[model samples]
Target: MKYRIIELSVLIIAVISVYAGLSYARQAAGGQTIQKGGLVADVRAKKIGDIVTILINENARASNNNATQTNKQNQLEATGDFGNSFLNNLSGGVSAQTQNQYRGSGQVSTSGTFTMQITASIIKVKEDGNFIIRGSREVETNGEKVVTVVEGVIRPGDISRDNTISSSKIADARIFHQGTGVSTQAHRPGLFTRILNWIF
Candidate 1:
């Protein structure tokens, strides 16, 4: 009976100590005070730009049996809806015509994850009544993915009477070819050169 009494007393003391410690912690936390081991931390966040991706399947067709066929199929397996929104915004309000030029008859897939960093500049008007847009976009796509950037000057005033421009009038054209940790700048056009590109 005496041993039982001693054990009961010890248990009561332990419970009372735990209750006291909990009460003290609650008061300290309410005031955002530092307690025995560590203090509560206040976190801050900053605003920054984002990179996004999207899955796009264009020129889709299905037979009566419902087997799907498409000219291009690109899937983006990234977290968040940022990728979808980015592609939608760039595609211009879900209209078909805006994204048509970028499409091709054969399958041109751009799947996989890519980190895109973009910076753009524009010259509103040229002396020859033409506008110039200079954009620098860095896209890290596939392992062997490469992009050849071209810079050229054109004279709109030199058009012939038939309203057709001559190709020989290209005074200066520079190309910056980049791929696989290798970069080269040359006056000649690279293998992936879209010679005639216009937006009206």
Candidate 2:
């Protein structure tokens, strides 16, 4: 009975030691994460309100062409026979004809590209371990002010060690850029053009 008790104790201790070694090995393989910030260099963003740098590179292109044509024609003719009478000179033959034609064509093409960077805040943590982030930026150059805003959802796995994520990895992204001042007005249509467009 004494030997059996001793063997059981030895088995339990060996099992516990093996489990501890495995736990340590796993931690070493994955590296350690410092949960505390401020004094330590913890760059990963894990919670709401944490900021992360976002790199944006997006582009768009579109083109369209259309044409229409229509044509219509109608003709009517009448002839009468008269012998040795003045009516023969005036009513010998009568003819009428009508024709209509229309043709129209149009073409349009547009393309644009945007590349920038902004610091975004984590707004929400999804149930599936995704993050909803929003960011905005404004820049002014020689009395021209441009504002940019971005919002999207990103997976934690896509974030780099420096807490930066590329725009391509983001899903359901909304990006807007607008400018004001002389440069903006220069690109806008003149009053005459606007009036013509409205009338048409």
Candidate 3:
């Protein structure tokens, strides 16, 4: 019985020594642990607010023993700017043209009465490349309610293989109104003018 107890004690000590040695070796080899708060560094040339692209690499072998390191890449894009003048004008302000390019994509999803001011322009690009746009705008209004807004996602497969209606056009104007209501002067001519036309 004493021999068995002695053997059990030696086995326990050996296992504990092995565990401590492994832990010490790992620390000496720069085994950095990735915690929940571990954030990758930002390595982008241009950045605006929360919209940023980070270039990063992985080193899982350092913390995970015998694990092959696998690098992962993620692309993130976010925008806060609602469509400005271009959209307002596109719907109907000057020329009238209907194209699905900028139809009902983005939104401002706000629940309040406020005036919005903005500037806008259209851009064309090829199929292959890293392209992104981020903007934000706001107006003075009462924010008594919480609102959640989302822009329509445009995927690569969503585009048409055959390019049609590639260009954009202006919108139209509203009806002619002289005062509070629509002006009926042109439709119903003055009595004097009617008499003059009959006499002529």
Candidate 4:
């Protein structure tokens, strides 16, 4: 009977201790206060692994024209009045004329524009609050695939309130756009042609 009473007392003590600990935690949580106006700032990417949207708006244009023309003419004439008998026959007239002309013209022009949006993950944070980011996106439509890749460093201040940044604002940026499909293949030279060009 005494051993049974001892076991019951120990069990009651354990239950009371658990209840006291729970009560203390609840009181501690309730006593904490939230500061006003502290949550008004927009969420921004500040840590490694955070994601940021990149707006791609790019345009390029180029043109060249070259023209050349050259012309030359030369004439030689000699006349001597030799009243003598044999020298007069040989000195009748001598004339020579030469002319040359050349003309060349060439022109080349190219223009392109790319616009899209992509998300990049911050891979590293610099000591000055800059971010190193890298990301890629691919889309397939009607058996055609287009791929875009971007990597660069960006300052935190450049990020907008919506946690987005323009691709042009990125420093030391590397961007690539590629397409693969039947159309692209048709535009490229054949394998045999390419090999022949390389050999020559």
Ranking by TM-score: 4, 2, 1, 3
Candidate 1 wrongly placed segments (more than 4 Å): 1-122, 128-130, 133-142, 157-168, 181-200
Per-residue accuracy of model 3 over 123-157 as CA lDDT, tens digit each: 22225522222222332334322221111212223
> TM-scores of the models, in the given order?
0.21, 0.47, 0.19, 0.48
Clashing pairs in 2: none
RMSD of each: 31.4, 17.7, 30.4, 13.4
**Which candidate number maximizes TM-score?**
4
Expressed as tens digits, the lDDT of each residue in 93-182 for candidate 2 is 766776655555554444797678999999999999999999999998877777888899999999988889999998999887666766
Q: Which lDDT values do the candidates have, in the order given? A: 0.38, 0.79, 0.31, 0.79
* lDDT, model 3: 0.31
> What tens digits encode model 4's per-residue C-alpha lDDT throughout 77-173?
7678756645567644666776655555554444797788999999999898899999899998877776889999999999998899999999999
Model 3 TM-score (2 dp):
0.19
In candidate 4, the residue pairs with backbone N, CA or C atoms under 3 Å apart (3 or more residues apart, or in different chains) clash, namely none
Q: Evaluate model 4: give its lDDT.
A: 0.79
User: Cα miss at 107, model 2 (Å)?
Assistant: 19
